[model samples]
Target: MLAHNQDSLKRTPLYSLHVSLGGKMVPFAGYDMPVQYPAGVLKEHLHARAAAGLFDVSHMGQIALRPKSGKLADAARALERLVPQDIVAIAEGRQRYAQFTNADGGILDDLMVANFGDHLFLVVNAACKDADEAHLRANLSGECIIEQLADRALIALQGPKAEAVLGKLCAEAPAMKFMDAGPHEIAGIKCFVSRSGYTGEDGFEISVPAGDAERLARMLLDNPDVLPIGLGARDSLRLEAGLCLYGHDIDTATTPVEAALEWSVQKSRRSGGARAGGFPGAETILAHFDGGASRRRVGLRAEGRAPVREGALLFADSAGGEPIGKVTSGGFGPSLSAPVAMGYVPTNLSALGTKLFAEVRGQRLAVQVAAMPFVKNTYKR
Candidate 1:
């Protein structure tokens, strides 16, 4: 996360509420965000997995794309020009994950694209929001209306009990399947809700007017099954879920294929498909789809209790030879009660059960390549 001076840091709508709840504030993405609460990161992580965790993600960017030609397909097609995803195929009231790619096949930023009938809604990383808006305006202003929803506050209600807690306020919560997104009324507040979140649990992300954010958050916290979560636990949860953090797990230098995100690129955007090779870096990215990338992102399991953090160099063996790869994200997974991490390694060494060594504190710690999502996902399909 990007850090800025405390004086220049922005505050989310829930800042006061977080302070009232005794949250430990820290600079994140140029905003003063809570890193943890009184209950601490460990408890918060486990609570979310067992119950529900409400997260203040107002820092994320929300944008709306309306077609000038009065057709949603026009907007989708225009978006397809920038991202490799099949936006045109996204059904109404459904959303899909996508990435903005550079001409050299590097990812500019990752985002969510939701089809809302006449328009498309996008949620992008907070640190990349400004640049992402500029990118859209530069490439899609003519074919679509690019409006940033700066007045909205995004709240994520994640975990297994998310539905039970949110259903008390919105009846439609029970009917919404994973990735289903649309407008809904919660506690008499008009909001846009999506059954998706960073955690590998069934949940909902609600976008509400900034003014009513505190009230909505307070109401959600009123439920016994829900607890307020902060950024610390959020990171560990996503890491355990095998999800990528924008700058750490992915960035401008990482291609989707190299990051093991080829699944986000739909078949329509692949070679010989209907809309193939129109996006930026289509040649390079698509080539990787056919020939494969030199390295692939894979999960890593440390043999001991010590966590191998980001930037830790990976070696082929404990004896110390040439560095084979590097750890990108790592921490103690609360769900697993052990250290889990994700890193990039040569395809030959990325297979499950492949043994590797990570240099931590000048000591070569044994690590094994493992399958991702160390914790099983409980999405309600």
Candidate 2:
């Protein structure tokens, strides 16, 4: 988690609610965010896996891209110029995961793009939001309206019981499959609801007016099945799900293919496809699509109970040697009850069962390349 000046830290609309719930406040992405509640991180992580967890993600940036020509395709086409995804083909009321790539084929930031019939809605990472907004404006202002939704507060209800929990308030929730997104009235409040989440569980991310955020959050929290979760559990959950955390697992120095996210790049955007290339780094990114990158991101399981934390140097053998790679994200996965980590290793050493060593606490610990998502995903598809 990124830190900021304590004096200048911002607060979300649900700050008061979090305090009342006994949340431990911490600095993250320039906001005074809750890292855990009274139940603590371990319990919070397990609760979400078994039931439901409510999270205040209002710190994320939300922007609406409206085409000047009053045509949704125009907005999508303009957005395609910034990302490698085939945005023009995204159906109305649906969402897709994408990334902003630099000319060097490295990721600028990852985001969610949802088509809202007349406009495209974007949700970007909090730490990169400001730069992302400027990038969108400088590139797409000529063809679309880049309006930031400062008045909106985002919340996520995630777990196996997410659909049932949200469906009680909005009848449309149950009908939404994975990646489905659109507007709906929940508890008499107008909101943009997406059947998606950072946790690899069935869930919904609701964007509501800031003024009505606390009220709506209270209504959902009133459900016995829903617990208020914080950043601590959020990180562990996403890690167990094998998802990348921006600024960590994937950064300006890591390409999408190197991060094992090539699945997000649709075929239509690949070479020889209908709308091939055109995005930043198209040449380099498309080239990697045919020929793989030198290093690849892979999951690792520590040999013992000790957790190999981030920044730990990795080597090809247990004996001391020059570092081959480094752990980007590592911790004890609450769901797996074992240490799980992700890092970049040479393409040749990324195969499952390949043994390696991680330097932790002045000792080289044995680690093995393992299949990702240590715990299977239960996404409602």
Candidate 3:
């Protein structure tokens, strides 16, 4: 990490391309990037669901882990000590979403791990990249070689037509199912393509050399179904899909079980398995799974037009009874045509159909605990 002038934010390789495409620039994660294009956030979001949208995500960190023993299982075993998930089970050319947790079971950062044929590839959050690299080095360097892929750029192509659009460029892209990653050549440039994205739609996340990012982006944008999207739409899309936005829905204060993410923890890592309870904070996280967490993360549906926002207080009654919980990620869902949010509330009040009220701007707004994904996920199987 290096000191930087607040006014002089960093820019990605696609800065000039975004500017040329009428992008609205803003500061995000220490980078001056596009928040939206001329078509606006709402349209950008809908376009991704209807057709296809290309997004610049080069701000995220990409790292490679190579095992000195030449055993891929060694790399996976090394990561299990820091996170709760079963990384060793991820087959070749597939991806697994996981988090780096601290000793207290609090998530340090959420990341995506891909098992390429010979080594493991990781894509960590942009803001936590430095710290994540440090943590990996301090804990697993003796078992595996860690290399940061800083010269690469990441872009996501999402929507119903994403497969058709990318398939036209690389014949092998559409062959990949959800969470699959494979190497391919697009526009005569080599890249690693993954059939996954933050958006809940079927899509591909392409990682290419930073020097060739703009060219590849331009080629994809030339398609009739493809349009450039920005961060504003990216947020709304992920929210409607009920995906957590790191620092918001999850943080150092939250654990996998409390966040309703036990599904990500492999069965082998839980109690009763032969190799269970070896990861950090195993006692705290495992206990919650058996005894139930005191508080749970849940999805809320706003009863009115007002969008419930993060930090809003939750009450069990409209009369503003004692606060029960608080909103973590709240926003208007473009696809749902209603406000959707996720929050933390007492376990007894987390079941679907429970009535609740969110305090917005001093006014209590009625809400209901609802099933997540405010919209359905359209990922390619």
Candidate 4:
């Protein structure tokens, strides 16, 4: 979805509103996106932790995989063939996170899959949408129909007060548990909402009609607790939550085992289970469950306030030993009031409390392996 030569960058439904609110826009995933608002990234990060923050994620691709018949399992089964996830076991009104892996057990893209009444809904990264759609068309049987809901827009309302704020507009929003999704009529607009998001907070991601999106967003902003947030805070929030940002934290060269995403591939997808080995790269991925990966991702905490930026090489000691790994995502965690980061290191050096040094600004900065979610995940499950 990159805007190559002769193609201009795309704009989201909320572009004008972002500009009106003093948002600083930047190009991201082929779209003109807001990096921060008038309040800045620091305040926006803290606001999402203490109150509710609304984010426009309409650039993401919303897809519907509908089987010819009403049996949802048929659609789920077809999807299971491509991903190493127990999609068949996903109950109605529930959602799960999954990745599309290439033949070598490398991630093609990470996406969110939700089970609606009679179909499966997938929210894929904007940059990989076209390729992902092509992959689906090539792999899924004809009986499974793939449709991209281009007329819809995705909005994320997150934080502790998110439920209460959204509840006032949609009565059922507050009652939903984490990863729950269902039909709802919000402020007179028919939409599908899921009690999920990337901020590691109790929140919801609402898929509303493109035409009604701006109205709904404005209405949500009317709430005292909701502030219009942008991509800057979104990245910092997810980074502090220990969540991976597709291209940075996980890419084509990284495997699930090495990325610390083993739990995503449930036991049913592994060897000795009822259904196993159907997904792409199953041999290599499943084998990793037993033999373990040579390098594993780990959470890191810098000793001081200076944030360790991505691509910083890691060393074993002050003597500048051979580089052990590289920082993938790193930033100042507002909630934690410290510099937090994640990186891949050798298995022996990835254990909690293990010491490592990041080459920051030509100096080796001391860092320690620490538990992730620099700020505890407050998901209301």
Candidate 5:
């Protein structure tokens, strides 16, 4: 469990190392975080696309759970009562992205569940860890164990050349495939390393003991291809990848069906099936499958150089008449070299190439519903 004392935010294992590298510190999720460095957001985004960048994500929470009596399969099944994924079929050392939902089918939080040896290792967002932990503890069966890895530090190395840069630190790095996870020693420090990341690129997430985090971070940064990245670039990179940001793109107000994340819900969870609808809000979510969602999330491309920020109003046409929806997340994409955004629109208006307009200040900018991820993903197979 994380220490709730005020001093917990004072420093991370890489605190001094981040300062040494010119990391601009800011408060985020109850910890001192780096927003960016002297290289700026654009440069960092490009660098991660071509090379590798080290991100200090130690603030994320890592927790482990195991069946108190029987095998892990039963515990995983219990978890399926909250999420829609078929966790019983999840193999060992592999992670599956899933979300927690409320009774109304709204998302509580999205997290990664890795089935380790006889246990489930969960990596959840720091901002929601307290609530998530309470939810899990109250929902899970009594015949299970929960252990929090708050003392561990997490780091991500992502990009096209990530493997090459990580290989210098661990010889076994080259053998890891996409979504595969295993333990490896980096310069004598052991870490739970996974070949996955938020950026739509080849990468690995290294989880190490809090004490050795700084040493390993320095070693990775020492590589010519690796630079320190922060939360600002992280958000833009994920947005450009067409990935959802929990609070902005999704929430307890948005169901998985409307969020275009039906892929996370398995076939067995369908309406009236054998394993049908065991989770909270299952009735509402399963109904969305047979019929359809009221509003659907889609990509938006704005005309001209002006970037549309969240809360911007969307109009039907260039005339700036009726308001259809609002911008959820919008910014200038460093990779696409253009302004990109995501928001919900009427199901009929969600089609690609549909014409609409985003009102920027007094100007009604010409906008269109477009295919997402403006940039193609390079995730390794």
Candidate 6:
């Protein structure tokens, strides 16, 4: 359904390359993205796990924030008013995965908040870019300059062999640890490289000027250890790793606590009480933590071949008739060779092995709320 408008959508910086390589273009987040190459989703997914896979993620929003006062800590503190993370303490060259939460404490968007010392670099969902930037501008106090990097290109190299591939281009890449980022020169081109990714594997996300993106992509593709992956495979990969997709598994209606993301709130931010907490929905979020939430995000597995998809009704085995929850993300995993999903169920039925039912196509499929990462994550810590 999301691909219905693919024909008229704009393409990314590597559009020509994707077309040249036989990409199956589809509409995703308002942009025409390659859902898979001629190799298809299954092979692309497998390639990324066994070797390195490159991704074109230029459609996502990139912004640089610099406070008029030129103080990075002050800017971070200002940002803290709208999000739950302890931004003040994030070291330079370090990256933190966080969220932009609404006044009700429900996530507006999940984002990567990176401290670039002199400025802050933010990467947010492409579909939510306008709203996210507007929200930041409305909330940030005083003089802060926000520069959108709409002309930049993003590429992710992920898999067990990722380091080997990147190391050959940037000798220092292999030495980078998880969540760490720095400026680097790769193949004579200056770029930003971070040791992180969404696929639950060892990886690096490279940000480069839009003009040089195609060249860099070609270079990476030429490596025997690397292949170009697409959005379809990216979806399956992140799902298998138990990561949440912004608009689906998480949204403005779901609180962080209910979303199983309490770790994003640091200990000090809680101990210091109300004044210490400045983000939207602080009261609701803190209350949920103290008393626990009514429902929680969990993994679900169907008993048979049919794939349970988003919006499928979830029923408790004990309480038969009415729906107790809904699936947010579900599909057949290429690697696991089975169906897997992430959803929210009432707290009482949110444990491993908790029997449930997914009503798909008028048939009640046997389902169970299972532990996440239906496949174990191989992230290099």
TM-score of each candidate structure, all chains considered together: 0.98, 0.98, 0.97, 0.97, 0.95, 0.96
For model 3 the TM-score comes to: 0.97
lDDT of 6 by residue, 54-132 (tens): 9998888998889889888889888888888888888999888888877887999989988888988898988899999
lDDT of 2 by residue, 217-279 (tens): 999999999999999999999999999999999999888999999999999999989999999
Error of 1 at 366 (Å): 0.6
Per-residue lDDT of candidate 4, residues 1-381 (tens digit): 544721587888888889888989888998889999999999999999999999999999999999877789998999998899999899989999999998898899999999887999999999999999999999985758999999998999999999999999999887899999878999889999999999988899999999999999999999989998999999999998999999999988888999999989888888998898798888889888889888998999999899999999999996646898999999888888899999999998988999899999999999999998777888888
Q: What stretches of model 5 exceed 4 Å from their correct place? A: 1-10, 272-274
Q: Is candidate 3 or candidate 5 better by TM-score?
A: 3
| Per-residue lDDT of candidate 1, residues 1-381 (tens digit) | 333367789999999999999999998998999999999999999999999999999999999999999999999999999999999999999999999999999999999999989899999999999999999999999999999999999999999899989999999999999999999999999999999999898899999999999999999999989899999999999999999999988988889999999888888899989889899998999999999999999999999999999999999977848999999999999999999999999999988999999999999999999998999999988
Per-candidate clashes come to 0, 0, 0, 0, 0, 0
TM value for model 6? 0.96
Off by over 4 Å in 3: 1-7
Question: Residue 354, candidate 3: how far off, in angstroms?
Answer: 0.5
Off by over 4 Å in 6: 1-8, 271-275, 318-320
- Using lDDT as the yardstick, the better of models 1 and 5 is 1
* Collision pairs in model 2: none
Tens digits of per-residue lDDT, candidate 5, 329-350, equal 9999998889999998888899
Model 3 root mean square deviation, Cα atoms: 1.9
| CA shift of 149, model 3, Å | 0.4
Q: Estimate the lDDT of model 6.
A: 0.87
Q: Which scores higher on lDDT, 5 or 6?
A: 6
For candidate 6, list the clashing residue pairs, or say none.
Answer: none
